[model samples]
Target: MSSHRRVWYPYVSPFDPCPPIKAKAYSTPPSLFLGYQPPNLEQFTPMEALKIGTLWKVFYDPWYSPYEVSTEEDQS
Candidate 1:
């Protein structure tokens, strides 16, 4: 018979007893590898502006400011 060694990995079963899992708080936000940048609004057309504005209204906080109320009326 040829001499050979066999290795075995410990098998974990569902019925096996496990220690209690502890939750850890993160000090910093997780990093995202995706190269994502916020959209630039200056290049948007009137139609595109309206569409984006409508969508933003549904959320509690919208990122972009489409309009600003002026205290003084237009003299023109």
Candidate 2:
């Protein structure tokens, strides 16, 4: 299967004072690959749908972040 995630190297200026990020990443939604919605698409469970913010599994495209900081609330 093809991945929705993509990576690229950004142009870093020598004159810039801050350190340059060698690579950056981003993702595209899975829905983009589909031409149209088909009949009887698979679905997630009721609780899973609420948590994932989508009912249909085919339409679910999770956000990918390089920096994810966990707080005390998340640990609990």
Candidate 3:
């Protein structure tokens, strides 16, 4: 299995006006890893498919916000 998210460092110059960013992260689609659909793959229910945005379970990659702030109650 491969990582869904990847990170890379951008070129930073000392002569730049603003502060430089060290590393940046980006997400790739799950379909890129799948070569072809198999005969009988697991599938999500109708209600679940509508909520998840995908009918196939293998293709479901939940989106997580990088800038989302978690409250103290959510930690538990």
TM-score of each: 0.17, 0.74, 0.77
| Candidate 1 lDDT tens digits, 1-76 | 1112123345556676895333422222111322353464234455765775533221212222124422222232
lDDT tens digits, residue span 1-76, model 3:
5667668899999999999888887778888899888879899999999999999998988655556633422564
Q: Which should have the higher lDDT, number 1 or number 3? A: 3
Give the Cα-based TM-score of candidate 3 against the true structure: 0.77
- The positional error of residue 41 in candidate 3, measured at the CA in angstroms, is 0.9
Which whole-number lDDT from 0 to 100 does residue 9 have in model 1? 42
Question: Model 2, 25-64: lDDT tens per residue?
Answer: 8878888998799999999999999999999998887675
TM-score of 1: 0.17
Candidate 3 — number of clashing residue pairs? Answer: 0
Q: In model 1, which residue pairs have backbone atoms overlapping below 3 Å?
A: none
C-alpha lDDT of all candidate models, in order: 0.33, 0.81, 0.79
Q: Which regions of candidate 2 are displaced past 4 Å? A: 67-76
What is the alpha-carbon lDDT for the whole of candidate 2?
0.81
Error of 3 at 31 (Å): 0.8
Evaluate candidate 1 by giving its C-alpha RMSD to the native, one decimal.
23.5
Look at candidate 2 and tell me the lDDT of residue 42. Answer: 95
Residue 53 in candidate 2, Cα distance off native in Å: 0.6
